[model samples]
Target chain A: MSFINYSAKEINCKIVYYGPGLCGKTTNLQFIYKKTRPEAKGKMVTLATETERTLFFDFLPIALGDIKGFKVRFHLYTVPGQIFYDASRKLILKGVDGIIFVADSQVDRMDANMESFDNMKLNLDEQGYNLDNIPYVIQYNKRDLPNVVPVAELNKVLNVNGVPEFEAAAFDGTGVFETLKSVVKLVLIELKKGA
Target chain B: MPQSPFVMYDEEFKELTLIIEKLLREANSKCVYLVDKDGQLMSAVGETKDIDATSLASLTAGNIAATGGLAKVIGEKEFSILFHEGERDNIHISVVGQRVILVVIFDKRSSLGLVRLRVKKASEDLTKSIEKLLSRMQAGAAQENILKEITDDDIERLFH
Candidate 1:
């Protein structure tokens, strides 16, 4: 349940990034942190382990301009991607307004990507958010890798409903903002429909 | 309907606000306020006038929500405090019984320990009030009717 503060005139929405470990969920946020003008963003908080695994989540509050005079802010969060952290991932899905599924494009990580996608659907379903309906987007990160899966095959297996997908090299800022923009744009459209 | 929708007669909410004010005063702080977990500004006291109390209330609630989310991920119960230390000024925030967040923004003349003690009492009071609010809400559509009872003028007040 989102808190609508009529007194503040700011509608804050929570959007979670769900994907497999090392699939660049955290890197996507780090890239956005570096790319966004400082004025447009707040402090980026991340809880990670020594080996760079996300321990809890990364939070970045981005101000996406005003709509009809209300300052619209989106709280972007990334769930810990490791399979062992499934419980943590489930907790982060509570009250989620939007989701971005980051798929690792490496051909060898195919099974892992599929597992994470299935996990995303299960977790979201448990949260009462339909994967097919909620404002959802997909990002195939690490496109720069030599062993990356072909976009066509990635689309065939992962893009079940033809959700907008992007080939991204998160470390290089590739397709990062495109993914964020599309999901956010969809969020606004949902807001317009009052859903 | 009870006397006032925005006003609380339950001694708990009132006393909670007073405790908050006392804490801020003792800290030589600027102001203080309590926001429910859902971001409702329960009671505010201080130079909240002319300032962005509404946004502060909502953001503080957001902070609590974020922290609560983190605690759950870590297998903890919940977070009750979030402190943002700054140069010359700082924001001392604490969550009360997971129901309301107590905030105190102070400058040079105070200690964090003192703020914590006062907030504990206020938190207890605020928690009781929220318990009542939740129970009242669970009582049924009466709460929705209460909102329905709001006049056009009140709705206008919300926008303006």
Candidate 2:
């Protein structure tokens, strides 16, 4: 849920980056954190294991300038993508305003991608949100890798709803801002409709 | 929309800040924070110059959410209160009105008993204000429609 603080003239929205294990979910966040100007971003928090895998989540708060006098801030979060962390994933999706499903495009990870996608829908339903209605987008990550599934096939499997999808490497920052911008736009449009 | 955005006006903000500031003083706490369940920091007071309020608010909500999940597994409705004691400071986290998280960070100067007592009284007042704020937001949401004034051009400009 977005938090509109009239007193502070600010609007805060939560956006979650979700996908299967090692699909570059945390990498996307790290790239964004590295590139965002110091003034525009807050400290990035990572709760990970000893091997640097995300155990809980990663959070980054960034100010996307102002819109019509209200300073718009988007809090970006990445869920622990490993399947065993389903409970943590559900917790992260509680009040999500928008979502970016970062799917690994490698041929071997297709099953993981499909499983995570289904899990997302189920968890979202449990939280009283339908995936179709929410402001959601998808990122086909690891495009730079060899043995990657074709973009057309990935779309055929995952983009049945055709909710704006991007092909990203995430490691070198390809398509990161584009995906972020697209989802934020959708979220703002949705927010306007409700208002 | 699944749920309306959490909105707070100036009046409610000041009222809440007053209650939190008072709690900070009475409880002898180093700091107090009012965070939305969605992890937005609504208001904070006391010594927070060096603290990362945003991260703290997010983690506090995560902690509460995880605990609430645990409560569910045990057939409980929710775990409303959470306390974390560090070597130097202790944090007292509680749910207020089931909508927001109330957090108090204190050190050796304050006792848990005193913080709990003050928090109980303050929670009552805070809950009342929160209820009023929610209703007001609901009533004004349609009429305000502030974002409706924003155009595609406005959104496009943000990317540049």
Question: In candidate 2, which residue pairs get closer than 3 Å at backbone N, Cα or C atoms, i.e. clash?
Answer: none
Measured against the true two-chain complex, the DockQ scores of the candidates, in the order shown, are 0.09, 0.79
Model 1, B1-160: lDDT tens digits are 0011222334545566667777677666778887765444666777777656645665676667677777877998887788898987678888776556788887667767777776676667667766775565445324323223323333233222
Runs in model 1 lying further than 4 Å from the true structure: B1-23, B26-100, B103-121, B124-160
A19-72: candidate 2 lDDT, tens digit per residue: 999999999999999999999999999999999999999999999999989999
Best by lDDT: 2
Alpha carbon deviation, residue B45, candidate 1 (Å):
8.2
Top model number, TM-score? 2
Q: Model 1 over residues A56-153: C-alpha lDDT tens digits?
A: 77878777765445566777889998899887787677667778999999888899999999998898877677787778899999989898889999
